[model samples]
Target chain A: MFTSKQMHLAQVFLKIFFRDRQSIIFNLLFPLIFMGVFVFFGGESEPINLGLVNNSSNTISQEFSELVEEEPLFNVTKGEESELKRQLFLGDQTAIIIIPESFNSIDETAEIKLLLDASQVRQIGSIKEAISKSLLSIERSLRNTQPMFMIKVEDVKSRPQRYVDFLLPGLLAFMLMNLSIAGSGFNIVEYRRRGILKRLFVTPIKPQDFIISIVVSRIVIVLMQLSVVLGLAILLLDIKIVGSLLSLYGMIVIGSFIFLCLGFSFGSIAKTQEAIRPIVTSFTFPQLILSGVFFPINSLPDMIQPIAHILPLSVIATGLRDIANDGVSLLMINLNTLGLFIWIILSFIVATKFFVWKEVAG
Target chain B: MNIIEVKNLLKTYPLPGNKKDSFNAVDGITFNIRLGEVYGILGPNGAGKTTTLEMLEGLKDINGGSALIDGLDVSNNAFKIKEIIGVQLQANEYFESLNLSELLILFGKLYSNEINTKNLLEKVGLLTKESAKPKELSGGQKQRFSIACALVNNPKVLFLDEPTTGLDPQAKRNLWNLVRELNVGGMTIVLTTHNMEEAESLCDRIAIMDKGKLIAEDTPQGLIDEYASEPIQETLKGNLEDVFLALTDHRLRD
Candidate 1:
């Protein structure tokens, strides 16, 4: 009996899923598109896009041009410092880091000014930081090691974590979870609003069977969608999975059920879409902030960390993070697995009992 | 034996924003329906007819009294009762994607095991529409299809809530004829409606209720003789509809 119901449910989920093309773009594609823009336009690029008109015949000026060419961050061209600065003002090359003929001799005591696009604060900050770091390396390696001045060279190693590598997967998981949990989860509320529950109430159907069928069907869809998004991330962004695929799949299955139950509970209790919108928003926002979907939740206040820990989002996020970062299995993270099931039970109880079927308006 | 029996049925709902106050939607109403008969409950709107039907169907809880169907209590034996009773609600919406055959088969699975919806649809004059979704059909076609769904469980008792509301005269006649045929074939039926003419033509007996109480209950002619000043037809006469109905026996021969 349940198998038949589950089949029917799968059919419903498939029909609804295929029919909705807009949500696919908004929920799935939107995140990847945002990431692409930042990585492309905002990232480090070639040195120059224009001709460098160099009037200086000085050796120091020629040396500076060669140095710029050697630097991967810059596609260096030869031009007078003043002309380069004018290009900076015209929104060219992000910012023109100019060096006068006297720049090579400045390592002894003089400071070199790096021109930045002051209007582009973020790019300017990153550009300035990168240039400053590189200059410090140059100063220590070449200038300080010489007997020209009483300068000491300290070898500093940069342990810069791949910032994009850490963030992109999290962003991908966040999108998948939101689409599965937040979007389709609230669809339960929509079903009630459409009086589908009322229709179900008139049947000889078991509530457990109905709910279980939905859970199964939704889990499959969520998993399928997450796979597609993950595929896009992998193909386009080269996102590598370091964790156990089994564990990742399990966490999502359990997490999807947990959040879907939360969705169901919200749908069941809310009187109208207006009432449900705020209630579900409150439920989901806390999960988003507390679960380390964007930032680490451990950074929250000491007093609030415990509260965050107990949230389904927190446990699911932790489980996902562990699986993603550590490749841990279900046995490796017993507490999270247990916590997820507990939440599923608690939320299902609330949803089953309070989920209103009547078309009561706000 | 009586297929359905109720004694002092009561249902109260908590009045919103009030902890102490409660409103009784079904106020100690009691009735019985024997097997192999069409029993209709008629009333004005807000008269607890739907509420009473909902309770008997186990869609709502009874605040007081006992209800037994086939000697099984309605409350404690909901699943047992549900398995045996087929229900069709007003506007009887199914998932917009489900075809006539699919829905019947689905409901049949809910009741028991695999089912053949072909014969059932044929009986309800919906054989041609087996593959058509509920939304694709007209109101009358949908209602008739709903009746076909209600019979899927091979239910001993069929409960319908205003089965003919929003239906055209021809469709309504078709439904009445179908109901009459079902009763003749020995299936008990319990229905709620505000249409007096429908009750007069199709129902074997009726319970007239108002304000959560049974005000009048008898055969349609008997209730009219007691309360109506004139003959039942004269009391609420239709200019031409009566002639149209009378000329064609209130059954769909086609």
Candidate 2:
């Protein structure tokens, strides 16, 4: 279905895209810089600084705080109750735990006071859970296995997904969307402004041929971007790609095509270059912020999460992470695949219906 | 045989914010272009000259009539029509960073026409500037490059709309000579110009339009012979400009 004319046009477009320094940075170098930063800071979670206050003479209290100190999740500091409380209140510690004097043995039950920094609401649950789990382990050592309650922790994946692993695929998806939407939209509007499309319309080449050329050219650029960014990420950040390379590329191709169609829709709707900015920003900015480029969709408000999850960028980013980090197959990522398919059809319809080949005067 | 025929071609546009109010941009104008002749549509700005030319070029839709090029309906067969017609729009812009030869080769590929890029550039006197970007070329060189691009398809009919509108006098004369040479090479030419001298010197026949209707149509000398009565002064036997001024009245269009 490809034509030589389309290939020739695509080659010409590549030359133009590369020759323009602004496009090179926007399309390629900026994303690479992002990858470098993300990879450098990837995977390492922040350590919570904790304050320990022991009032009891019991050795168990001393041992329990020592256990908590050894855990990588916390940076432990031991101090007097008043000082610890002051530090906790001053926002120097994430939480302060106090073991009272009466906390003795298996025969007696003693109360422990846990003063948590309420300002950091998001970390409260995890901190509470980790401390409680540690206490349970200490209690189990004291009281023999009553078997009243048993909880076993297990990882779902063969390997745990680090923050970098989470970020790499999302960045990839974001890069593809940026390349397609901004790149494609800017191109058509520029050609329209310059009357290039009007000039081409007088030729024997059909509009379909021109569109095909654009599609082909955009795909080539997207691929180059993917390889460069992903290559640097793999070499520098040590990002693990568990999924098939073919499948990852395949997903990106389909994903980029969807955004390219959206770009065309924006191009057709915008009458001039000035009009293009707001239109494209309106489309891209929402997805960039809300579509889980930096964080998971669940991190957003519950009311907006549903909307964010369905965004093309969200679906593609999440889907790529699933395949690359979770080792999920292409067919298994059906929700994202289905969402992208719907977008492709809808955007293609809008583009074809509203496409303006020449400047229409009022 | 007439190479192009227009029969009561019309284009009406609805007034903004008033759905029911409509006006004819080109109101049922009719004209035929003969084979190997330079036909000029002469009119001031906002005179609907461009609308008529664009409709025939398949760049605009005909609201109420028919136009045929080489006996093929323009509306139904715009693609086929485009294959055989070369167009130089008033604002002829091209892709940047592409040299003249690259742009021409790209244009030739669009038409599926195998063209000699060097020969095409030489015809427009831009062979020496073949490697220069379109933006780098001078205004007159740019116009010549646009013409070169248009001719890439080796078109049967060439259309130039105000092709010399922004050129210096020397460049304008150079373009006039180029147009004359193209016409002599047997390409049926249809151009629109508001310059009376351009029309008189370049066109074999002229159609003068004002406010969407043809006020007069004839050869340059024939128009003067028929309408140049009551010249500005008895001493100055008026030319084609006098014929145009006398027909349309001396008033600024804009």
Candidate 3:
């Protein structure tokens, strides 16, 4: 018989949350709230304080200046060459459009020169190309009523994904690792500290059952949170997941177990929260950043790639990206799956070995 | 019959860095607590009273010695022993939001034989406070609730560690009374305490230990007799507490 002991344990688990719903909200829901608030309020920031510096005072300059002024991407500024450079260096000017001091007669290879803040390389590239094309069209239109040669810069009006969609998956990944890590870490430490595991030494309950119950509960809760968020995302935003929902769910659940095992291993040895917290953060933060929670892992150093590629979140994020965007089965991400499995196994071995039931002295 | 049997059992865990440094919290102490008897282990703090109690309760590793409960080795057959013994830990409590009734049902579900929650709650005089959360209850009430939990499994041996250490006088009296009531029902009780009054009033046999060794063991009267203090002078009179109880029907709660 499993006995009411297991049921009592379940009650204990739920009761812990019930006792501190406020703390739970702060710990589990705080990151999500911040993500939502910042995402919604600051969605796709408009290019603030845009400027275009024009050096030449010719008709093309005047016409192009007017065109650039009309576009939302630029707040056209007419200035001397030094003034534009000074503004660009001071972070005041976004870009400078310099028309060479040439005769209006040399209409054949009229090159448009743009001086942009070096920091805005990506923005400058797109903006400069569009401006050059627009100028060509405008220059052509002036000569002929049929517009012999016209260059018009066009900023494509393709709408970007809303901030919520951009952020929710990352938020989910962050929360999953965080909760599983917190739950398993604190629960096991508590077991040792409160002498519960020491007490369980008197029972038939193996350490495995205790560990399994905790990991299973955490994974279930993670899935529950994912399902709710996933359903809401589909209903509210008309977001459609490209990959198999089941595969994503399975990967996430397995990832939670990996984090849980990591937490338990830490918890078993650490007697207090103060002791294991820094260790937990050491594990969580590096994996969080290197796992590419917010950005691409490839952006980091070449040396870090191997380490980053192995984190559970890294693999999960890749799997999620593939599933949600590419519509591929998780098994296709075999190397990543194996990497996470290695992490789970390695953490468990170390943790189980070092875990003392109560105090080492006890 | 002896319910607890222990012999030359020893435990030594290697210290982290040094091969020579080892803590013998209980060292190699040995003793037995018998059936239906109130046995007490008295010691100053850190003298291994708690360690000894834990070992008997199967909460500690029997490093280099053997401890048997009802002929079952404590180290090897913990679960079988757990079914027969109940333990009330010193700092054990709920998550603070669990009501008395909810906690009862939760622990009640842990055993093959469950105690009637209503009856136990009433017996502890917390029947009216069943819906109150653990935090909402006073210190006295919390202790009562804990004892109630220990009894939920209908354990034959009940182990209480410092059960009434921090309670007020009247509350302590109530605990002493409760201990007597449980003993009357044929429960074998072994407890650890530093309070001499508790030992004198509740424990039928008292064992005083120091430096992980049992220095003295005898009945309470016999112990008083051994020390050559007249029995009445050394024991509680049950005087003011009973008088106060008669004058005010309500129990002193906190």
lDDT of 3 by residue, A137-165 (tens): 55555554465454676636243355555
DockQ computed for model 3 against the true two-chain complex using alpha carbons: 0.31
Off by over 4 Å in 3: A1-8, A15-20, A23-45, A52-64, A70-72, A78-92, A95-168, A190-205, A331-333, A340-362, B9-19, B112-115, B229-250
Q: For residues A1-362, what per-residue lDDT tens digits would candidate 1 score against the true structure?
A: 45676677566666656667786666667766766776676556555333244344566556545555566655555567677767767766555554443444543454455656678445556667777665555555543464344556553522332445555545645654565555445776666566566556556667666677777777777787778766776687666667777877877787787677667766666667788778867877777777676667777889988888888777777777767655577677477677877887897776666654432211
Please tell me which predicted candidate would have the highest DockQ against the true structure: 2
Native contacts kept, each candidate:
0.31, 0.73, 0.31
Question: Quick one: best lDDT, which candidate?
Answer: 2
For model 2, residues A220-283, the per-residue Cα lDDT tens digits are 8888878988898889778899988877888888888888888887887788889999998888
Q: Model 3: per-residue lDDT, tens digit, B1-254?
A: 89887776565656769889886666677677888999999999977888787877766767778888878888777678877888888876564566788777766655545557799899888999878887788788888888888887788889899998888777888888998999999998999999998999899899898877778889999987888575456555567756777776546755
Candidate 1: clashing pairs of residues: A47-A74, A47-A75, A243-A327, A244-A327, A268-A355, A268-A356
Weakest ten-residue segment in model 1 chain B by summed lDDT: B229-238
Query: Which is better, 1 or 2, measured by TM-score?
Result: 2
In terms of lDDT, the poorest run of 10 residues in model 1 chain A is A155-164
C-alpha lDDT of candidate 2 relative to the true structure:
0.83
**Per-residue CA lDDT of candidate 1, range B10-90, in tens?**
989888899699988888987888888889998888899888888887778778999999999988987888878888776
Model 1 residue A5 CA deviation in Å: 5.2
Which regions in candidate 2 have their CA more than 4 angstroms from the true location? A47-153, A331-333, A356-362, B230-254
**Residue pairs of candidate 2 with colliding backbone atoms:** none
